[model samples]
Target: MEVLQILHMNKGNDETSYAQNSKVQRKILSVVKPIIDEAVQKMLCSNIAPIGSMGIADLGCSSGPNTLLLISEIIDAIHATSSCSTSFTEFRVFLNDLFSNDFNTIFMSLPAFYNQLKEEKGAGFGSFFISAVPGSFYGRLFPAKSLHFVHSSSSLHWLSQVPPGLDCQAAGKALNKGKIYISKTSPQCVLEAYSLQFHKDFLLFLKSRAEEIVGGGRMVLSLIGRSSSDPSTQESCYQWELLAHALMSMVSEVNT
Candidate 1:
């Protein structure tokens, strides 16, 4: 499937856009801050030899407040611990996401972002160079052993495409009817199909990232998954059922 050609979060700062709806993601970032801080500290300290530059990539780095904010946090951690370390004098930050992501919005925000970094770091932040690399993280986006730190939040739950065995459609019947994802109403096959897709995509993601990240590198990720073995568990699957009901209600109202 050409999943790479179509995956993108909603754009802009409007009510319906990802920018406005990313508070949950921001909260996840906050929860993971200490981990991030520790990772940067260790990455800096582990560099016994001068490495010239530190390469950092934020996979699924959708554009918005969290984008530059996360970068700022990482740089601060590095400075607090390794500002004087000649092992890494420069920082290369890669902001990566799908091709259709609103890179323009991120780019426009850069002028303000750069100014804020300078204001906060007092010109020492001048060492950080940022760039956009739009693509899927399910595959390799960086060269081998190039990145020292990686970060991704609220992005990996998405599969490259709809799971297999779900493509079955006849004249009128739907395999997983009246729902957008695996729900209580869905059959066992639907759950298995979805799980299989996730396993395939996630494995590929790890394999790809493994090649790009350097020795002693670290990655921080936040994704949606279930603690239970059963995929039909309400805690993991109820939200989609509710959404389906809401969507069908709207459709019924329009039709009537």
Candidate 2:
């Protein structure tokens, strides 16, 4: 199956949905708030003129409370920095994600979100136009040189697709058998395939963003990462290992 076509977080407000289980993502946003603030601050302080309408995009913005939290934080930073000026009056906020994402849930929450914004930022608060753009961030999604500030959190580690040749059907056998992600026991080819995919996807991501982001635009991206040079390091792959183990146990029970 095509990963992009099938991949998306659980939808809705149910107990198993991403909206209910995204506390880790929320924490990630909190950890990166200062960096986001710093980027917005620098963007405002820059010489980019005609600041009446600022374009901002949160790529891979999964549906959840954290989806709007980033926008709120950006608005807060702008308010703090532009208190003395009226130059920044309009906001064009883009929330982007995969095609299968639960955009309806996000849209349903917009009315209340706007109300909160109005109540907190006051009547004089600048107008914002928020729209959802569904697609992969590995390619261009916005008009050329349109975005000023880009923010992505807890999302970039997702490659554009599964690394080539690792698919069991295509490879004639399971390459990284019994494991969904890199592990210490993963073969050299499996490791290299994943690494190559990441590098390729990341390069495309940067190139696409470069075309969409203005000359002085800033991007802040946060994702699960490893400190060591090894891709199979426990810091990065341990979660996947645990998940794989759980899945294997389920398969064993089914077979029995």
Q: Estimated TM-score per prediction?
A: 0.91, 0.94
Considering every candidate listed, which one attains the maximal lDDT?
2
Q: Which candidate is the best by TM-score?
A: 2
Error of 2 at 140 (Å): 0.9
Q: In model 2, where is the ten-residue run with the lowest total lDDT? A: 79-88
Question: What's the CA RMSD for each of the models?
Answer: 2.3, 1.9
> Candidate 1 — which pairs collide?
none
Whole-model lDDT per candidate: 0.84, 0.89
Candidate 1, RMSD to the unseen true structure: 2.3
**Model 1 lDDT, residue 105, Cα:** 91
**Candidate 2 segments whose C-alpha is farther than 4 A from its true place:** 83-85, 168-173
Residue-level error in angstroms, candidate 1, position 85:
4.0
